[model samples]
Target chain A: MTRYFEDLEPGDVFETSGYTVKKNEIIEFAEQFDPQPFHVDEAAAEDSIFGGLIASGIHTMALASKLTVEETFDMIANLGGRGMDDLQFHQPVRPGDTLHVELEVLETTPSERHSERGYVTYEQRVLDDSDAVVLSLRMETIVRRRPEGQTE
Target chain B: MTRYFEDLEPGDVFETSGYTVKKNEIIEFAEQFDPQPFHVDEAAAEDSIFGGLIASGIHTMALASKLTVEETFDMIANLGGRGMDDLQFHQPVRPGDTLHVELEVLETTPSERHSERGYVTYEQRVLDDSDAVVLSLRMETIVRRRPEGQTE
Candidate 1:
């Protein structure tokens, strides 16, 4: 049985595997979508305002989402989520920057109308090897609750 | 000529052409990346919590980026963005959700080091057919300033 609302508790934390950012991946992702000079060519990036190539913010966010799925895909009974908040690019993540992610359960509450479901809030944080924060996001999602009448 | 940093004043607004969201596009985007049940299968979504298929939030954001690019690609220096803030998914956008985007310049600052470049912030809003806001975002971008030595 999948974990539902009753299984989640405040203060739960999940640590994710880290991944290295490759120069080619960053360049390709930005070229087709972002197309900014700094994100396209390494040499061109040095002359641009950022003074170095940086990973596209979307790529970083997408990686974080993948880590979340890898950790909780089976246990999760996810409904949907509010968009991210307080997203800051603290330091530019270069080609070699390895990103590690963590998610913390912030709050939980039962839905008013749906006794079979509840809502949860989480703090998703991404950090570099030096433990500097790269991005932080807050989200809220709905999850099913184990029904009172059934004990599974 | 493209609008430069010096040309943007607070309250300046730009509206983009409407675009239709196709089912295959949403499904393909979600399946390869997002992989959420509600985003992948219409029938499965109907049996699931959401009651129908929905676009991934990231897909909506990317579409918004496409709209922004179409409107300003040639006009701006395009130094990439600081981050996104105040993102809200007011309603679930299914296939055939025609979307139009609007952006209003909120602030501008000249670059101290780069005489030909500066930064600007805009309040971006996306609405659906009924004029309801489907997404709201705030963005900061870097754009080239008209050359100080030039007389226009």
Candidate 2:
């Protein structure tokens, strides 16, 4: 597991690898939450505006969260986030599309309380096999600081 | 069913008064998508970072979508939109927090290709019983033109 906020620098990067975007997962999630034609059944997708199965934007967003959890080794006690900006589905992420993601720290600040923690913001992006950008988001998270006696 | 885009004017207000937020719904939705301690089980919530079961941010976003749809009455074929800018949880939306919403038109413009249609952007807010602003979002939707082929 990576160290906490006190250890994160503005330029630090964390990569999450080996996650696959499965079609069934996309369909199921979309059916429940999104329910848009292009995101549910394949036949319905064929007739929809997208003309093929496209992952629901919300589903993609959730998967990014899952990726963050795995890469962060479940270290942070997530206090939610400030939501997202510039979220774009540049290209369709279909089933079998292996996902690779990197989160780079953009900024950090000490929290109001000196309770061994600080806040860090990251610019996260997910890419597919062809190096196409599938998703991009900005997330702010609170992380524990190194113990008072710990070394750098 | 309420009116469509062309029918909505600058000062118009629409509300979805029928839906009430239930605890079980929040728990179920959170368990599947969010799956955080504060959002899933009540007992787990006691030990959670959040004091009690809270709705997932994504689910809150979806509820906003449902209210918007109820207002639009399927008149517009929604193109995707720019993602949210600021999303705050405010007071955690517990079950039984009846979700009532209201929206105001912020701007409107014509679509170049579809002379019979145009796009409208609105500032939507979701409030709880105490009328606290629990959630707020901006939506830009394409709306069909009135029979007179209005120009704006």
TM-score of chain B of each: 0.92, 0.80
Question: TM-score of each candidate?
Answer: 0.86, 0.77
Q: What lDDT tens digits, residue by residue, belong to model 1 across residues B11-34?
A: 998888888899998898776557
Alpha carbon deviation, residue B104, candidate 1 (Å): 1.6
- For all candidates, what are the clash counts? 0, 1
Candidate 2, A48: how far from true, in Å?
A: 3.9
| TM-score, cand. 2 | 0.77
CA RMSD for every model?
2.8, 3.9
Top TM-score hit: 1
Fnat for the candidates in order:
0.35, 0.28
In model 2, the Cα lDDT at residue B14 comes to 62
**N/CA/C clash count, model 1:** 0
